[model samples]
Target: MSEATTHQIPGLKQKKVFKIIVLGDSGVGKTCLTYRFCEGQFLDKSEATIGVDFRERNIKIGHEDIKLQLWDTAGQERFRKSMVQHYYRNVHAVVIVYDVTKPETFHSIASWMQEVESHGLMRAPRVLVGNKCDCGTPESRLATTYAQRLADKYGMPLFETSALLDSECDNVESIFMTLAHKLYSKQPLRVVSVEGELGPGVVTLGRQKRSASSNDSCLCS
Candidate 1:
């Protein structure tokens, strides 16, 4: 990584880099949610995060090449207590998650959000998600009215997502895509000179091909 990354929408090497931080209480499926976003397949028994984990994926929004650096923060209080504030610094977006089956997890979002406000860069695009919606009726427990109100209050998109559901795969991807677009759209486009005519059609990210190890866990080196 450079000493610092730029947020320019496009350039000769405009990668449209964005650092996204995923936060929630432990067992809220933060890891699974991230893995699903990065790998497009859910792991029901993936290894638990001891402190933090990360994965990167590149995407395209119009002609801009966008790269997402997703940081999966350990949600346990013990881990949070010792983590430096810089862990949340200079982020381009935030993803706050909770378990739909667990009301307490949803309730804990306030404290989690507060921690973010205290530590994170201001005005980053934020998303709120209710994970693990695959196991049960996704809408039965959480009040959509209340969640919408919360989202409106913070100007964030709220979603009830299931990493395990094929239908919900787009929802997970949309959170980051929307954020990337928002960041890219706001900036003035630059006319960067390149060697030849750019190819047509979307450039595949090449990250969707995830293979499982001998123990049946998705592994990406």
Candidate 2:
């Protein structure tokens, strides 16, 4: 795991941090998708998330060094209202992930969306991701047509990704980059790069009642 240099970058003059939450049901490969994008590797037989794990990375979009706080919340149904509630604070964008091979996971998007919306981030930019495209046969893959329909219904951009294949890494990264651009283009967010900042790949979790560190907050002026 790469140590986060987000807080350690010298001469980080201007920076903005955007909070993005990944939502889905259990066993949908949410964690794998996150690790693939942040660390560029896949975890096999990974245990489910206990609470939430977030990674911070600063990606330059045009002239802006935007620090992205990617929060990978536990997709277990039990965490939706209670655990997810504490972490959703200041979320700027949300990515609802579903497994392409699991119809039930895809179906849970609506419920997940509802939980997120109720948390006062309804105006945040939302994206629908169908993950784990590398799994299952073509016949078992969730229909892109149906996924697109759902995306349209929610007015969220839809993306299908595979983390196991190295070639698809760009596709996965683009999802966050695109939203960062969209978010920056919408408003000039106020985030000052601070000393002692952490890197994006840093993972923070708990066995229960978990929340991301306050350092992830973007102090918008």
Writing each residue's lDDT as its tens digit, candidate 1 over 12-107 gives: 364656788989988898898889888888887887687878898988876657888899988788888777355676576788999888889988
Clashes of each: 0, 5
CA lDDT, every model vs. true structure = 0.73, 0.77
**lDDT of model 1, residue 109:** 82
- lDDT per residue as tens, model 2, 40-96: 777766788989998777789876577888899887777765777888876888988
Which residue pairs in candidate 2 collide?
4-199, 7-197, 55-200, 56-200, 57-200
Best by lDDT: 2
The residue ranges of model 1 lying beyond 4 angstroms of the native Cα positions read: 1-13, 120-122, 138-140, 187-221
